[model samples]
Target: MGVGEFSYRISISTLIVVFPLLFVFRLAQGQLHVVGSLQPVVAGPGDDVILPCQVEPAFNVAGLTVEWSKPDLRPDPNDRLSRVDYVHLYRDAHEVPDMKLPSYIGRTALFTDSLREGNISLRITNVTQEDEGRYRCFIPKLKSQTRFSIVRLIVDPSLTETVTTKAQLDPENFHVPDLNEEIDNKGGSSERCRLIPVVVLCVFILLCFAVGGCLITESQKAELKKRPI
Candidate 1:
C-alpha cells in the first residue's frame, strides 16, 4: 500500500479502539454526530457561542459531509437529501439528512466558510434559556467513515447576554522592533560596504612603497661606490 493508505489504516485501527468509549459518552448525553463531536459550547441566554467543528490532523479532506441535529432524531435512510428547520423557520428537519449532522441547529448556526474542509460546528446565536440542552456535531468523510462529539449547553437564567467575536474573524498581532536597534543594524551594514574599498586602497599603497624603497636603496649604494669614500 502507498504511504497515504498505510497511514490511514494505522490511524483507523487506533481510532476504532477508542471510538466505542467516546460514542458511549454521547449516549449519556442526548447527542449524536457523524464524523466528529462539538465541544460543550457555553453562552449566556440569548448570546451566541461558535463551536469549533474541525477534523484532527487536517487530511486531504475533500467531498466530506457535515450537518447538525438533536439526539434520537436521525434522518430517514430513504432520502439522499434532507431539509433542516434552521434553514426554514421552526419546522422539523426530518426532511433533511440527520445521520451526518449535529443536534440543535434550530437555534444554532454553522460556519459555512468552506464546507470542503469539514468544519461542521454550529454557532448558536441569540441563545435562549430553553437551548440549555445537549448539542452534537457529526461529520462523514466516507460512506463507512464518521466521527461524533457532543456539547452540553448551559444558560444562566438571570444574566444579560453579549455578542462574541467570531474566532475566525480575529486580527493578527504583528511585532515591532526597537528604534535604536533598528538604526544600528542599518549603520553596520553600510560601514561594511564602505570598508571594502578602503582596505583595497591601503593594500595598493603598501605595494607601491615597497617598490619605491628598493629603487632608492640601489641608488644610494651606487653613489657610495662612485665617491670612493
Candidate 2:
C-alpha cells in the first residue's frame, strides 16, 4: 500500500474508534443524573416515611454519596425556603462532623450511604405536620464525582402529624350530622357553663339574706325584752 493510503486508513480507523468512545461517555454521563422514587407518598402519623431514590447510571456508582433535604417554609426565596432549598445535608461522605443536628432536624432520620444498591432512601421517623413538603435527594457517583439533582416530594400536609390524637381533628373539614344539632350542642355547653355559676350565686345570696333576717329578729326580741315591752 502507498504511504498516504496507509496513513489515511489508519486515521479513519482512529476516528471511528474515538467517536464511538466519546459518544458512549456522553451517553453514560447524560443518564448519570439523580432520580427519586414516587413521591406525594402517604403515611399515617408517627410512622416512618422512607424516601427512596437511585442514580440513573447505577452499577458504575462507586463510592457514592447522598444528601437528603426537606423543603422548609422560609422567608428567603431561591434560598430553599422561599423558592429554593430550605433544609439539606451533604450526608454520607461530607456529613458535617461538628454540627450533627440540623436546624430543621425534628423527628427525622436520614440515610445517605445507601446508593450502592441504588438505595438513596431516608427514613423519617415520627413524621409530623411540618414534614409535609418536597424532600430532595441528591446523589453522585463519588468515583466519577459527577453529581446531579433528584426529584421533588410533594406530600400532603397531614403527613406531618406525629402525636397520637383521640381522632384527627381537622376543623377545616368539620362535618355535622345536622346543622341544628351542632348548634344545640354548642348552645348547651355554653348555657351549662354560664347558668351553673349564676344559680350558685343566687343560692348563696338567698342563704345570706335568710341568716341576716334571723339575726335581725333575734336582736329585736332581745331589745324588746330589755325594754320590758
Candidate 3:
C-alpha cells in the first residue's frame, strides 16, 4: 500500500477503538438523579416515621452505597469533632455498623427488599424531638455520579381535643329563648294585620245583604197595599 493509504487505514482503525471508549467514558460521567418528598414530614414524638427517597429512572441499587445523615445536626461548639455522624449506612447491600452513629444505631433501618425497585427510604422508629431536622439521602458512585435528596423532618406533640358534656354546656348562656319570643310576637302582629283585611271584607258583605233585604221588604209591602183593579 502507498504511505498515505497506510496512514489512512491506521487512522480508521484507531478511531474505531477510540470512539467507543470515549462514548463509554461519557456515559459513565452521566449524573445521578434522586427524588424525594417536597413537603416536610411531620412525626409525633415516640412515633415511627419514614423518610422517603428514591432513584429516578429506576436502577438496581443493591450493590450501591446508601448514606443517610443529618445535615443540620449541630454538635456543641465545645465538642471536638472532625466529622458528623451518619444516621444509616449501607455498602454492598449490607449495613455498616461502624459507620452508623451511636444514637441512631438501633432506631434506624433501611428497607432492603425494595432496593431493586430503587427505593432507599429510611425508617426511624421511636422518634424524638431531637430527630427533627433536615436529613440527606445520598448514593455515592453507584453508576454514574453521586446523587442526593433532602428530607425535612418536623416533630410534633400528640394532640387531643377535650369533649364537653351536656352538663358543662349551660343553656342559660345563650339568649335563644328571648330571641324566639321576639320572633313569635312579630309573627302574631303580621297575622293580626292580615285578619284586619278579612274582617273588613266580611263587614262589607253583611252590609250589602242587609240593604237588599230592606229594599225587598219595602217593595213587597207596597205591592200588597196596592188593591187589585
Candidate 4:
C-alpha cells in the first residue's frame, strides 16, 4: 500500500476498535443524578417543611447512602473526604445516629416509603429562623459532585403568623347569632318577663292568706283569755 493509503487503513481500524469500547465504558457508568427544585422552599418558624429531592431515572435507592446538609455550616478543613456534620444521613435502609448533627437529630427524617420511587426528600420539623439557607442533597457514591443540587430555604415569620391570626379571628369561628335564633331568643325573653308578674301575684296571694289566718288566731286567743282568766 502507498503511504497515504496505509495511514487511512490504520485510522479506520483504530476508530472501529476505539468507538465500541468507549460506548460500552460510558454505558457501564450509568447516570446517577440528584434532582431538586429551583425555587426557594418557603416555610414558617415552628412549621414542618419538606426539602424535595429525587433521583433521576427512578432507580431504587434503598441501599444507597443519602445525605442532606446545610452548605453554610463550616466544613472541616482537614478532612479530605469533605465530610462534615450532616443534617441527615440514611444508610443501609435506616438513619445513622452517629452521622447526624446534634441539632438535626430529632428534627430531620427521610421518607423511606418513597425510596423505591427514588424520592430522597427530607422533612424538617419545627423549622426555626436559623434553618433558612441552602441545603444540599447528595449521594457520596455518585462520583460526580455536580449531580447534587442545592435547595434554598426561606422562613417567613410574619406570613405564617398572619395566617394563624386570620384563622383564629375568622367570623366563622365566633358565635354570631342567626336572625331566626335572635327572634326566638327575643320571644323567650318576653315569655320570661310575662312569667315574673304571675309569680309575684301568686306570692302576694299566699302572703294575704297567712295574714288572715294570723288575725283570726289572735282574735280567738283574745276571747279565750277573757273567758278563762
Clashes of each: 25, 9, 0, 0
Which regions of candidate 3 are displaced past 4 Å?
A: 1-31, 74-81, 144-146, 159-229
TM-score for each of the candidates = 0.39, 0.43, 0.53, 0.55
Best by TM-score: 4
Model 1 global lDDT (CA atoms, 0 to 1): 0.44
Model 3 RMSD, rounded to 1 decimal: 38.4
Question: Which candidate, 1 or 4, has the higher lDDT?
Answer: 4
lDDT of each structure?
Answer: 0.44, 0.45, 0.63, 0.64
Candidate 1, which segments miss by more than 4 Å at Cα?
1-39, 59-62, 72-107, 141-146, 165-229
* Model 2 regions more than 4 Å off: 1-26, 59-65, 71-106, 111-113, 140-229
The local lDDT score (0 to 100) that residue 93 gets in candidate 4 is 80
Residue range 91-157, candidate 2, lDDT tens digits: 4444443332344455444444454555555566665555666555544334322233223333345
State residue 33's C-alpha deviation in candidate 3, in Å. 0.9
User: Candidate 3 on 25-80: residue-level lDDT in tens?
Assistant: 55534434555666667767777778877776577798888988886665567868
Candidate 2 has a TM-score of 0.43
Number of the top lDDT candidate = 4
TM-score preference between candidates 1 and 2, better one: 2
Q: Write the per-residue lDDT of candidate 1 for residues 81-182, one digit (tens) a residue.
A: 853322211113122423233434455445555444545556667766766655444443332222444445667766667786223411121111122212
